[model samples]
Target: MCLDVVSRLIGLHKLFLFNFYPYVQRFLQPHQREVTRLMQFVAQASHELVPPDVLEPVLRALVNNFVTERNSSDAMAMGLNAIRELCSRAPLVMNQDLLQDLVQYKNYREKSVMMAARALLHLYRVNLPTLLHKRDRGRPTEASIELKVKQYGETDAKDYVPGAEALVNDKGKKKTKEPAEPTEDNSDSDSWVDISDNEGDFEIDTDSEDDDDDDVSLTVLNNIIVTDKHISQEVSCVQVLLGKY
Candidate 1:
């Protein structure tokens, strides 16, 4: 396919052409087997025709080959992809209206940068679903756990305090009465309980981070809490009221 000609056709026209290419890879859905095959011919025939309107026959021909859900989706994907491809060559910028249209049509809005970003996001949705799952994920520990209090719009003012205390994972443990004294037999295992069952219950996945795999681990995505009030706003709480005689 000539890049120049493909670049000129925009909107619906460009979209139709993209579908006619059958597909760039084996990603061509199975139901679109016939439409995929038919589009190849349409694309070839389209190249020979002088009139741009002649592409309709190819569209009709391509549409005829579809009977399943995959074929239907293939047609939509092709046209949207075509328009999106052509939009890259366009000089003018696209807007929210175009983005809205692409979203409504479930097509790529190549004209708008936002639309392009959204399309890329959709591609991620289809390609990477594991990103939604929460596990033993880890983000960079660089984000200061130190408490910093600041009002809005204040850029220069910053006061750092101590970080949070060590986390205790035992949330459900109950308090028991302290024994008068420790005995020899009970001293062996008095401090702990059998946690074999809970071991598998609280499973944290350190893997399955498709997007963050290269930069950070998923295990780091956690909430940090300040354990001591003194560490936070230690100066703010200062009271200097003295009684006068």
Candidate 2:
């Protein structure tokens, strides 16, 4: 529980790795009692927030001390399990050569050890397949190949709603119609006014002003239509780039 809380903190993970990890590494030997529980604790403490360089030594020590051929079958299985848990949380700590070597233990004599090795192989096969030997890597789908590993402190570059441009265009069209309706109603009422001899010049002036208003309205509507088309084209291009068809 303490490890669970401490590992969630930002800078404290590095401190835990530096001060506490080496002490746990010492007890990973075959003769040590409750070594399995100690290894589990070590795995729980590891997280992606910690740099791979800091965690690499701990993985190497576990492999060298417990997963070796000289260790008993139980010790080897425990070591492989610990490594799997560690990698599941922070796979960047493992190098290609080390991962390739560990996956080869799938053919170990003991069933428990073999299963543990195979589980490790399966985990990487889905996540970091390039680390495994080609034969062991198997066929990956296009989406799987495109999967990107998130590095420590890395954040997404683009954070926006999809189809937002379309929404904006829709709202703009609604706003343009609202002001246009009132102008149209006023123009219709003005067209019904009675004209006399003295009002003839006034009627002519009113007609000229209406013509000017019509031209301005046409210009505004044309611009809005062109803008809508441009926004639609941009949205289509973005969809194509993202493979949305």
Candidate 3:
């Protein structure tokens, strides 16, 4: 509930940082009760809207208090998980050196710690690959390399909505010229129908035999239409009788 509220109300994020983060940092010890929950809150609150400068200190505290070698494997794993969550939301808060150092734990002896570190590394590689070392960054595409990271309070001021470019029309655009109407002279040349030059040699039929076939076809069509109308009327009568009309 608190997470949902903080995420929805951007203003509340600052209050969370000013009030809750400091308290979490103060009690961020292995022996402290709810230390994990405190760290979780801090991580969950690290949204992209919050300035990286403000969140960096909290990230530093998490690293120093729990992610160091001095802490147990469990503590390190929890800290890494929290850091991963934080970075996933606001990766700009983390610096290159810190990120490189964190990724080194992918080779850690503890399996849980190792997995947590890999997850963090994976998150950065996907979102902010430039921050990771070249070797650890993996094969980023040309488009991914060109991806611009959004700064705090930065707005993308596009003139038009994306995917709607084709719908937009320029002012004073000239209308397309329609083709000129074909004259009698050009009609035969332009027409798609292939006319043989020797067409006058063949005898032309004034009355087509197909005229009788067309009349028969019309009669058949009328019969079909009448039969369909009768069937529909019968179905409607049945539906009305069954109170389903």
Candidate 4:
């Protein structure tokens, strides 16, 4: 093949692998280069770390063909599985910068993929006493919907609902909606998590004689409203990104 053609193919392959390529890239380009690259990685990681052969069919399903829910879920599951497998095989002290980027993906899209986030969090055992902040990352902190208002970050990076940190209440309340609070044990810090905190104030008390389970579920989403003002600077590092979307 000509050098220019090979270079263009390599660039297209990277774009497709990175999920940045649009609809046309797959059909417009061929799989020849990606297949070759996959073979190289399979051989390299096989001897060194990964179960190279165990994942061949998964790659074939993902990159070798087309997109559908089945393919997409397979891709996500494969990516998540690979992340965990490699994390376990690798030494401790996974790179902080790398972890931050990967954890943010399933959040903004409402994929609720905190499973992978938590897997990585526990694998790396990161206990950032404060938030992993980045400045001016290009994501919207506010949403028009009430269900997702609590999703914002204080740092320049996008705020996130950390792995299983949102919606699971540690404390019980008599009110239909549990009171809003940051999930982090940042008692040392004077900060209060305001994500959806204020919007649910009108919720019917769960303990009230007139209230029922259905009412409780209704008011619960109110906690995720636009007017929430629970932001405080004195929060743990990990919880900082947990509240905002």
Candidate 5:
């Protein structure tokens, strides 16, 4: 974990230890979760793992790798974040070449990398004596929108002439009428006709004069009856009729 050991590891060309750049968060992905445990361990023990002497060289290697070798935008972003962390933690370790690389990276095609580069540049400005004017030019600012308008833009309102008229076709014009929609009354002989039943013939009464009509109730019923002892009932009815008379 010490700087001397990390430096020796970096020197070993066959090992390619610098390939595991922190800029891309997926550096440990190729290792299939094995490198993740080691990264976590290093993070937890970063103070004890990497000594002051090794920090600069390790950061330099990381910056150089991302700037040259790593093609992934994500990795470049992560590396830029790591550079910022290193600059904040130990600004003196950041060299001029590293600062210039970050500045150049501000225009990276990947938005994440550009943002990270801008952040790293800001940190560099604080830690080192970078030009102040480059800060605004390095990354877009709120004023850029207005500045762009000032450069190559126009307003929605333009100077108008009082007598201007829209173009009209006057050559070989013919008089034409649009077909009218068929009404429910079917008054027009050329109008559309319905083939179905006369349900469409019903008129919607909009006249308010019929609103005063009284309400009416109507009901109809049918009934059926059967009898077998009709003679006894007829005799009883005749006797009662004679007594009443």
Candidate 6:
């Protein structure tokens, strides 16, 4: 009935209720069920409790107790739930240090504590964007490009494949290609080519031969017979050049 009366007074005479905020702040200590109940009432009507200045102190006190004191599991859970509610309803009223301290409970061994802490963390994260009111920067205005290059160092030169990393700079060093294996045809030195000098044309060495070899000998023996008339003089000149008798 007393709690009922207080709730009624808070709803009806909210202006007067604001005046008693300091008294509530001073009296509400850790592990106090009555004080926790009153806080819950205020939290339930948080939206109507305008000018959040008073509520911030009250919630901060409860959070401080929840984080630092050895309150009952029920009380701790209540505090966590109330904080989640406060964050959703009035995020600006939350204490940053208290939220940071409460986050530690997410890693607590107790399943209920961990669960409650995680829920609160989720609530906080969900509302963070709203609280921060970040601008809708469709994308990063400043262009940033990240480049990663990996260099492998070989301790032994023998392990390096020839020309594999030729373009790669290695402390001002250059690598050359390995010599190709010799083939059988190119390995032979005394290969010969047929020579024909008196056929009205010269023959070039098609096989491996030294550049100085020019063995060409032709002798015209008798009167040269011409078949084509237009090129007859030209043919005679060629025959005379071949030492025609």
Ten consecutive residues with minimal summed lDDT in candidate 6?
A: 141-150
Per-residue lDDT of candidate 1, residues 1-245 (tens digit):
45334523533253444443333322333355453443333333233222333343333333233312344454555544433332232211223343334445433232343354356335323322223122211223433222232222223443433331111112123344455888888888887766666666776776766656456432443333332434333423332112110
Candidate 6: which stretches are off by over 4 Å? 2-16, 31-36, 130-245
Q: What are the lDDT figures for the candidates, one per model? A: 0.36, 0.74, 0.72, 0.37, 0.47, 0.53
Q: Spell out the clash pairs found in candidate 3.
A: none
- Over 1-245, each residue of candidate 3 has an lDDT whose tens digit, in order, gives 57446534544444434555565567777788877777666766667777788778888888888898988999999989989988887778899989999899999999999999999988988888888887887754443544566677776664322322222222114355667888999887777766578968767785776675422344555565555445555544554356643
Which candidate tops lDDT? Answer: 2
Tens digits of per-residue lDDT for model 5, 39-110: 332232233223335456556555655544345787677667766765554455556655776778788788
Superposing all C-alpha atoms, what RMSD in Å does each candidate have to the true structure?
18.9, 20.0, 23.3, 19.5, 35.2, 35.8
lDDT of 2 by residue, 1-245 (tens): 56445544523344444666776777777788777777777777777666788778889888998899887898899889999999997888999999988888999889999999999999988887878887897654443454565667565453333344676566668778444445876888877867666754663335555664422344555566556556656665675457653
The parts of candidate 5 lying over 4 Å away from their true place are 1-53, 130-245
111-203 in candidate 4: lDDT tens per residue? Answer: 434465555444433322112333312222222122121111222333433333333232223336856876567764656555555776756
Q: What lDDT, from 0 to 1, does candidate 3 have?
A: 0.72
In the predicted model 6, the residue pairs found to clash are none
The alpha-carbon root-mean-square deviation between model 1 and the true structure, to one decimal in Å, is: 18.9
The TM-score between candidate 3 and the true structure equals: 0.58
